[model samples]
Target: MVEPLRPPPRSARDDVLTYIKTLHGHQHHDQLVAVRSLFTWAKQNGLIFRNPAGRIKVGQYEYAMLQPLVPVQVDRSVAVATTPATRLILTLVAVHAARVAQIVTFMLNDTDLGNRRRTIAGRVRPPDDLTTQRLLDWLEHRHRRWPNTANLHPLINNQTANTSSRAGSHWISAAMRGQDATLERLRVDRQLEEARVKGPDPLHLAEDFGLDEKTAMRYADSARAQLPQAAEQPSQ
Candidate 1:
C-alpha cells in the first residue's frame, strides 16, 4: 500500500529561532529545563543519538529595579512642570505617594479640603502642606479653565472636560513627558523616603498607601538595604 506523503522535519535553525522567542529572563530558564527533559528522555529511549541542547549555555538575568532620581533630577522635573495639572500630579506622586491609578480615579468629592484629607482608592490619607497646597492650586486652575466641565474626576483635560470620563494614563504620562523623573519614579522615591524615615515595615506601607503585599514587600526590601543603621533606632 502507498504511504501518505510527509512534510520535511524542522531544522536546527527552526529550533534555535523558537528558543530566541522566549523572554530573556526567568522564562529562559524554564524553557531550557523543559527542553533538557525532552532531549534526555529521547536519548534514553534511543530515539536520538544525543541531547543537542545540553551544550547551550544561558546566563542568569537578574532583574534590577530602576533607581530613584537624585535631588538635581527631582528639581529639574519640578522645574519643567509647566501646568497646574502637571504640578499637582508630580506633587501627588512625590509627596503624597499617590499611584497613577488612584490619581486618575480620584473625584472632587474624594477630598475633604477643610480636613486636609483625601481618599485614594478608598484609603484615606492626610495630605501634607505641600500636597494640599498643590491640590488647591490645581483645583482652582481646573475650575477656571473648565468651569462648564461635567467630569466628576478631579483631573480633566480638553478631551474629557465636556464628558463624564476621567483622564487616561496616557494623558497623565504625556503631561510629564519631558520631566527628568516619571510619575512612577517619583512615587517609588516617596515610598522609599517614608521607609527610610519610618523604618522598613511592609505593613505600614500597605496601610498607608493601600499597596498590595507584593508591592509593599518590594519597597520594604529596597529600603532595608539602603537605610542607615541609625534609621532603625527608635527616635527619642
Candidate 2:
C-alpha cells in the first residue's frame, strides 16, 4: 500500500492558531482571544517570522464567534428555564452581554446591587454592558431564596482546594443540565400562556412587565417562533 501523505509544515502562528482552536468553548475562547491580541502585538513589534494569520480575515475564525442573544429571546429563555440558578445565569448573560462564565460566577457584595456591576475574573474583565442592570434586577427578584448574606460561590469548582470526585462532577453536570432544561421549558410555557391570556405581540407584555423594549420584542418574537406551526400558520 502507498504510504499516507504527511501534512504540510505549519508556521509558528499556524501552530498557535491550531492550539487555540482546540479550546472550543468556555474560558478557552477568552484565552484564544488573548493569544490573538498577542499575535497582533508580535506583528507590531516585528517579531513574526511568518504572518500566515494575517491572511485570515477578522471575524472569519471559529475562535472569533460571539453572538449576542436578542433581548426578547433572552427574557423568554430565562423565564422558561426551570432552575432558579439557570434563570439567573441566562438572564445575566443575555441582559448584560456577559459571558456564561461571568454570569455563573458573579460575586455579590451588598455594594454590587447598588453599583449594578461585578468584575469578571480570569480573562475579559470588561464591566457588564447596558444589559447587566437588567440581569441584576431579575436575579435579585428571582433568586430571593438565595441567602441574603453577601457571599457567592464560583460557578466552576474544578480549581477549588476541595477537588470534586468523578461522581460529583457527573452529579453537578446532571443538576446543571436539568436546571437549564427546566428554565428553557418554563420560558416556552410562559410564552404560550401569554399568547393565550394576552396576544402574540410581546411589546405589550414586556411594557406591562417593565422590561426593556428591545428585550421584550425579542422575547415576543422567540415565543411566537416557538409556537406550533399550525398556530403560526396564517388564516386560510
Candidate 3:
C-alpha cells in the first residue's frame, strides 16, 4: 500500500534545504516563499508545531549581484539627464545615497537651501553646495513653469499633480539613456563609496544612510573586499 503524505516534522527542515538547493535563481527564491507560506499556514492551523521552512537560509549571492556604478558612469548619467528636475533627482541619489521614492515625495518644506540641508524621508541630510544650488535652480525653473500649481513636490507630473514612484523611476531611466545605469545602481554606488571612506561602520550606515544593521554589514563587507591592500596596511 502507498504511504500517505503527513505533516512535516522538524526533521523535514533538512528536506526543505535539499529542495532549495535543487532550484536556482528566481525559481529558487519563489520556492522558498512557497515553502514558508505553506509551513506558516500549517503551523497556524495546528497541522504542524513549528514552521520547518523558517530555519532554511537562502544564499545571498543572488541578490548581491547588483553592482555599483563607477565614477565615470555617474558623471555620464548626470550629463544625459533631460530635465533640471531629473538631473537634480539623479544628483541627490548619486551624492546622498537617497532613495528614489524619498526624492519623489520631497516637499518644498523639506529643503533648507540656506543651510544646504534637506529632509529626505524624515531624515535630514546635508547635501553639498553644488547639489543644493542645483536644487535651488530646479525650484526656480519649476516655479516658472507651474506658477499657479500648489503641488509641493518639485518633480510632479503636470497631469497628476503628484509624482508616483513608477513615474519617478521612469524619469531616471529616461535620463540614463545610452548610459547603462539606474537610480538604484547609483544609490548602491554611493553607499559603497560611503563604506569605503568610513570603513563600513554599521551604525554610521544605519544613522547616516538609514540602512538597517544587517544591510550595513553587507555593504561594509563588500567595501572592505574592494579596498586596496595598502589601505589595509598598518601604520608604520
CA lDDT of every candidate:
0.80, 0.47, 0.76
Best by lDDT: 1
lDDT of 2: 0.47
lDDT of 2 by residue, 1-236 (tens): 99999998877767777776676555565666666677778878999855555554334233322122345644544455465444445543333334333344454441254465455443222345434555455555534543242334423232331332111233223433534333334333444445444665766655444446655665566556556554767996
**Residue-level lDDT tens digits of model 3 in 112-203:** 87777788889988768778877888888877876776676667656635433223556545665567667788888888888888886777
Superior candidate under TM-score, 2 versus 3: 3
For model 2 the local lDDT of residue 107 reads 47
At residue 79, what lDDT does model 3 achieve? 73
Q: Judged by TM-score, which candidate is best?
A: 3
1 or 3, greater by lDDT: 1
The positional error of residue 30 in candidate 3, measured at the CA in angstroms, is: 4.2
Cα TM-score of candidate 1: 0.70
Please say which candidate is ahead in TM-score: 1 or 2.
Answer: 1
